[model samples]
Structures are given as C-alpha cells and as structure tokens.
Target: MASTTAFIDVPESPDRIWQLIGGFGSLPDWLPYIPESELSEGGRVRRLTNQDGGVIVERLQAFDHTARSYSYAIEQAPFPVTGYLSTLSVHPVPGQTAAARVEWSGSFTPVGVSDADAEELFHGIYTDGLAALLKTAQGWRG
Candidate 1:
C-alpha cells in the first residue's frame, strides 16, 4: 500500500484545532479544494465536492474528542486508489501553550496509477490541506 503523511504547526490550542476540524463533515471549512460537504448516515458518512467538480464519499470509522483524532475510509473518490484509510490528529506541543501540531496520514493501494504517482497525489493533497488549515487558524487567531 502507498502511504502519505503531512503535518503542520498551527498557532492554536489543540482543543481549539480539534473543535475546528473534528467534525466528520467539516472538510469544506478548512480544505481549500473542497467546495461543499454533506453528511448522512447519521453523520457517519460525508460527501465532499471539490473545486474541480470531483466528488468523494467517505465514511467515518472512528472519532475521539478526548484524543483529538479521527479516522475515515474512502468509499468513493476520483483518484486511482482502493482501500483508502486516513487519520487526522491534533497534538498539543509540549511547552507551547497556544501551539499544536496537526497530522494527516493515509494508506491505500493504487488501482490504475503508478505507486509513486499515487503517493505524490496524496502527499500534495495533504500538504495543501494542512497549509489551508494553518492559514485559517492564523486568521482565527488574528
């Protein structure tokens, strides 16, 4: 399986960051490429529409507010991937009262694409997502 992980430091409390991104259907709020999101299955499923008109459906596998983390599996996506599982987590930095680290990681098998290309695609997506989250967190702080 190809895997990708990305991290970003945000000037916000871990709890605050979790409050911003913890919801299963909150991608459209911080993910720049996501234009909108809809939740169903009693908030266990999320459908995200991207800026390029691509749609991805994901199912929440796990969530822990106290742990500040969540995991999801992709049910449908535009990418050439299968068995995709991803986790997003927030951790408060030690000794940093108002700083936190956010991580997004995913593992999947490439379907019709090269493994390297698939890894690159996911890495780019995570990088863009983390950057957007950091920017928004900064704006909230400002």
Candidate 2:
C-alpha cells in the first residue's frame, strides 16, 4: 500500500478545530473542493459532490470524538486508487493552548498508476484541503 500524510498548524484551539471538522460529513464545511455532502446509512456514509459535480461516496470506518479524529474509506470515487482509507485528526500543540495541528493521512493501492503518483495526488489534496481548512477556521467565529 502507498500512503501520504499532510498537516498544518492553525491558530485555533484543538477543540475549536475539532468542532469545525470532527463530523463524518463535515468536509464541505471546511474543504472548498467538496461543496455538498449528504449523509446516509444512519450517518455512517457520506456522499460528497465536488466543485466539478463529481460524486464521491465514502463510509466511516472509525471515529474518536474525544481524540478529535476520524477515519473513512472511499466506496466510490474518480481517484486512481482502491482500498483508500484516510484519517483526519486535530491535535493540541504543546505549550500553545490557542493553536492546533491538523493532520490528514491516507493509504491506498494504486490503480493504473505508480505509488509515487498516487502519493503525490493525495498529498496535494490533503495539503490543499488543510490550507482551505485553515482559511475557514481563521474566519470562523464561535
């Protein structure tokens, strides 16, 4: 399996960051690329609509609200990978009560692509998503 992890430090408390992104279907709230999300299967699955109107369905694999982390697996998507499992977490930065670290990591089997290419694709996605999350969190009040 190939994997990639991306992270960003934001000037927000871990609780605040988790409040923004801890939900299984909260991607649209922080990730601009995903404009819409609908939950099904009693909130265990999410159907996301991208900016380009592409549909991506995912199933929740695990969640730990106390830890501010969640893991999910792609059920259907246009990505060139399979068995995709991803986790997103918020961690408190030591000595920085007002700051938090957000990490996004994924592992998958490449399909019709090299491991490097797959890693690059997800790394870019995670990095860009985190940047967007930072922007959203910064502008968030409450």
Candidate 3:
C-alpha cells in the first residue's frame, strides 16, 4: 500500500474546522473540482462527481465529533486503486491560542498502476483539496 499525507495550519479553532470537514456531503461546497455530491445510505456514503465527469463513491467509516476526526473508505473511484482509505482530522496547535492544524492522509494499493503515479495523484489531490479547505474555513470566519 502507498500512503500520502498533507497538513495545513490555519488561524481557526479546531472545532470550527471540524464542523466543515466532518460534513460527509460537503465536498462540492469547498472542493472546486467536485461539482456535485450525492449522499446516500442515510448520509453514511457520498457519491462525488468530479468536474471532468469522473465519479468516486466513498463511505464514512468512522467519525468522532469529540476527537475532531473522520475516516472514509473509497468504495469506487476512477483510479486503479484498491483498499483506498483516507482520514481527515483537525487538531489544535498547542499554545497557539486559536490556531489549528488540518491533516489529510490516505493509503491505498495500486491495482495496475505504478507506485510513483499513484503517489503523485494522491499528493496532488490532498494538496489542492487542503488548500481549498483552508480557504473555505477562513471565509467562514469572515
């Protein structure tokens, strides 16, 4: 399995950030690449439609409101990945007052793709997604 991780520091409370990130069907609200998302299975699953007509079905595996973290597994995706799982978490920046940290991490095995390509793909997604999340979170405070 290959893993990728991305982290961003923001001037917001951890609880505030978690409220945005923990929304299972809020991808399109912040992610520019995701044009639409449909929630099913009583909001436990989300079907994300990409701008390029690609689709990914993800299921919420675990969520902890108190911990400010959530984990999801990709049931179907456009890429050749297996056992794809991702976790998004918000943490307080110790001694930073209201500052917080957001983390995006995923692990998956490439079915028929090169490890390097898979790594690059995951990294790019996390990098862009986290940047947009930070932007949205900042706007929430304004």
- What TM-score do all the candidates reach, one by one? 0.96, 0.97, 0.93
lDDT of each: 0.92, 0.95, 0.89
* Model 1 residue 26 lDDT score: 88
Residue pairs clashing, model 1 = none
For 20-51, candidate 3 gives per-residue lDDT tens digits of: 77798988878889989999999999999999
lDDT of 2 at 34: 96
The model with the greatest lDDT is 2
User: What would the per-residue lDDT of candidate 1 be over residues 1-142, giving only the tens digit for each residue?
Assistant: 8998999989888989998899988888888889799999999999998998888999999999899999999999888999999999999988899999999999999998988999999999899899999989989857
Better of 2 and 3 by TM-score: 2
Q: Given candidate 2, what's the lDDT at residue 22?
A: 94
Q: Single out the weakest 10-residue window by summed lDDT for candidate 1.
A: 133-142
TM-score of 2: 0.97
Clashing pairs in model 2, backbone N/Cα/C closer than 3 A: none
lDDT of 2 by residue, 80-141 (tens): 99999999999998888799999999999999999999999999999999999989987875
The TM-score leader among the candidates is 2
> lDDT value for candidate 3?
0.89
